[model samples]
Target: MFKAGRTAAPRTRPTSMKIAMIIAGTVIFLLLGLPLIVQIITAFRGPFLPFGVSSAQWGVTNFITLWELREDFWGVLGATGAFVGGSTVLSLLMAFGLAWITVRTDAPVRRLISVLVIVPYIIPPIVKAQAYLLMLSPESGVLNQLLRLLPFTGDVPIDPYSFGSLIFIQSLTNVTFPFLMMVPILTNMDGSLEESARVSGASWPKTLRRVTLPMLWPGLLGVTVLTFILGLGSLEVPLLFGQESGKNIFSLKLWTLISSSSGQLPQYGLAAAWGLVFLVITTIAFAVYLRATRNAERRASVSGKGFRPSTMRMGGWKIPSMILVTIFILLTAILPLLALLWGAITPYPVAFSFDAMLNRTSFAAFGTVLADPDFWVALGRTVVIAGGSATLAVVVATVFAYGIARSRKTPWVKAADLFASSSVAIPATIAGFAMFLTFMVLNPYIPLAGTLIALIIAYSYRVSIAYRSSYSATLQIRPELEEAALVSGASQLTGFRRVVGPLLMPTVMAVWIQMFILGTNEFTLPAFLAVPETRPLSMYIYAMINPRSAQLYAPDQGAAMALIFTLMVFAIGYGLQWLLARRAIGRARKAVAAPDLTPLSAAPGGGGEDPSATVTIAVAKRRARARVR
Candidate 1:
């Protein structure tokens, strides 16, 4: 009789496979890290040619020049601080309100409200900026026009291009982010804390202040830091709205140093210097973020028992609260969208009036955009680069995650993870600049700058950072399933393909779609790396709205292109969501039909002596059952 309890010899991966994994990890680390190395070297080099071409003579002149040119540096810093600080605070407040209403209260139409809140985020920031500009431009804003129609209203109520307006626009664009972050924390928090407070004779308000707020402090702080970092690095909003109002933030200042010729050579060294400054700021912020999250995780108080938090009854306030949320959605998403639609049709920005609507409304802008051959080229390039980069990033990240998960004992895998994660602290503009320097310095042999390939590389690098974190989590959770496959006479590749692959498909697809959305809207990377022939739609839109581009500046045409792009993004997002939903349903059905074959217990002196033996026995029994069938 066969001894079913006998332990088998330990399995090891092939030597060639181990070598290949090491090689891949090294390549990933180098690719992700090379840009920073280039930036550091470029920052210290002396300016010799136009656009700060490196002289190879190392010195502190760049830093000194940056200091001497600091006439308005303090002012720019003040503006940046105000923009980042105000946007963070306001965004947090708005997010808190939305999260509380939706998660804590018996708010009307919670599902609709949640969807509306996320809609603005789905709309690209470039498009949102254009919409806001149309609605808030001082002389011809549609909102201003509506106000003028009111009694005794003469001038525009508010200028869209002011510092305060910058904060407002940034807050509106970012509110959904913190709201998304907070909702899950609010949903998952142990309800017992709040229940105990209420039971101790505390009023709802007191309970919230003492119990709920304290529990949420970590998430709140983490989101605050994240939002502040995002706000600080924001380029499009400041470039579009702040520039006209003479508000110079650090990002815009850095852009000007790199892009503006101003009848003089571009200050590449100074730009690099500025990039270093921003890098330091981002690094410090990231450190703080890490600490806050660690502390929050330590303080987490989830209980094993499943209990739902009680929702507050809105009572007489229900209808009014719903109205307020509806209004918020209208202002945040609908109004901007309507503004874009109006601008797309009109010949120029105009107030809402019957005459303007009837005569000025036409598809001339779209016709112009579509008629141009360059538009088609740009559109094709955008789709290919965005889709390709997202796909490539996901594939590479998945491989890296798998390698790291399986080879946690290997030093190279740890190094790869560290290098990839560090890229998160690098700001987008700085990353773009770093790519620019890397390509420029090596272009003689490699010839990558000013090409679509370079843009793809930049976008892939940027996205892989997020994918690494996502894939790492999913990989960690399912190692035992893969081990079970291995125990049942499956090779590593076969096991991953048959077992882990199926489980990871949904997560992989979600990451791919999100990365695609982000890639399509990417501005800074393409802005620095793209040449005229290789320009993507994002660059096209930027040119149309750019005040300095006299020949290319066409607000109506830009709005038309933005609207088209926005619709495309939404279509892709919705399509993917539907597909994933159906896939999930199919999986659920299959799971229901399948018999449960999980191991009941471990037998003595068996391979079941190991922790993973249960999974192995379950898988083996399932295989035996399948053969019998």
Candidate 2:
């Protein structure tokens, strides 16, 4: 029907869609990238507002100020290096051990251990620090109180403020990320290579070192880089435990520069200069990881054929491995949680005594915390912040994710993806500082400083996270579904809404809950922007125990507040998980109850059998397994 020498008109998106995409791209860039740009420019300038505010000359005055604090800077750098390095090493060791036992070795109660391992990850960083503070503080610390019971040990045996304690407590939760990273790698790794080495007379350790580890180099490197980066940006642990031990960290220095409470104006340039160090370090580390990943991929272990992942027989080591895992779980998660409970129930800090716990335990602290009007106000504000930010992040991320997945070659859409992900390298601390500077610059025009809108906007830095998750989920779905909807006379937006949205619901909820938890627990952004009226629960808890807040410092009441907060978080997490599981189970049952009809000629056996029926049955079984997972 086409005429020769006539060209078909090119396909083009509707003008409305094009304009919407442009607006979205602009907003994403402003929301995510503008703050960093503002901070970078501020670093070059003196202590003054940006955007034509009258201030000092632009030079390396910030660097000069840094030089003036070189003595303090170097010491903080050394402490930071030690803390990050030590925590990285310890976290990797623990994570790898747990992953190996759960994935490769025949360990008892592997399922239970796997679930227990992630428990600490769910606990807020500040809560974990507070738990240890209760357990290990030299004076009135539960552990020290118990230690003094020994006749031979007259003085306190440990100091919670030491670097050793700092690394240990940080490693407790930091282990979860590396553990998550390694689990999939180990689960899918081919066992044939290790088997061949073992059959060739290599010892288990030799085979592991030469064959298994080399194949896993890329994953190990990725985990190391991420864990190290997390360790570097840590704020709560160092702030809580490092102060008394003189272990001033880089993050704390940045906090001090911007949020100094000694009746002085904030040194914006100095804080930005300090924050820039994190940006630089993260960039270099990420570059190294990319190069290493490419080289390591040359020796890929997984393939479509001959891929066998077998669990190792623990043999005589089974009991020891089980006992060791049990002890690790107890020490890392259970003990710390119990410490919180004890602190909450007791009128004051005391060693664990069953007699006293039964006879003298009081819910008075819980009652006191619950009775405060400020507590209720903080709780309400936290819920709104978490819910609002999570919803906004998911929406923005979902739109960008859909565009990136659908329009692979579109330049503007590709740029939109880039702008959205540009914030991933910026840690919460630096991002918070940057937002602080940005709001100050725009305060005259926007008047959003110290507002809930400011906190919500700041927390949406996790849009990058949500985008990554949604993008992966979106890619798994075939575009043909959308095409089919469009062929049936639906608009593009309608097709996406009716076809793709249903498929993405599970991923959407997961990302939302994750961002929600993060928003609830994070205090760095709130630390800079929150005033009294807008302060959320995490900031409230931090202030409660802060030594500077002498009048507000009440460890017992803070313990009660933190315990309640932790319970609420856990309830939300597990309750939603349970609901999702129930929904999946119901769908699976319906899938099984449904019947199918197909031509016998298409069946494999071809003896009056229906291939469609077999497929339906197999799909139902698969859904069952997915629910279990």
Query: Which of the numbered candidates is closest to the native, going by highest TM-score?
Result: 2
Q: lDDT score, residue 133, model 1?
A: 82
lDDT of each: 0.76, 0.79
TM-scores across all candidates?
Answer: 0.87, 0.89
Candidate 2: list runs displaced more than 4 Å.
Answer: 1-17, 145-154, 244-247, 295-297, 354-360, 409-419, 587-629
Choose the strongest candidate by lDDT.
Answer: 2
> Any idea what lDDT model 2 has?
0.79
Scored by Cα lDDT, where does model 1 land? 0.76
Write candidate 2's Cα lDDT for 1-629 as tens digits. 96689687999857543455556556667777899888988888866655666775678888788879888778877877787888899999999999999999878889989999988878877888888888786766766777788788767777777778778878876888899899998998998889999999999999989999998989898889888877776788877877666346777777777765857888888788877866888878877886899777687888999888988999999988888888788767887787787888877666677788789798899999989988889989998998898998888778668867888568866667656775666667788888888999899888999999988888887788888898899998767666666556666666556667777888898888888888887776787779888999988898887868888888778889998988888898778778877887886697456543232224462457676755544443333333323
Per-residue lDDT for 331-444 in model 1, tens only? 788888888888889887777778888887998999898787877788899888988888777766666667667765577656666666676677677778878878887788
* TM-score of candidate 2 versus the correct structure, residues matched by position: 0.89
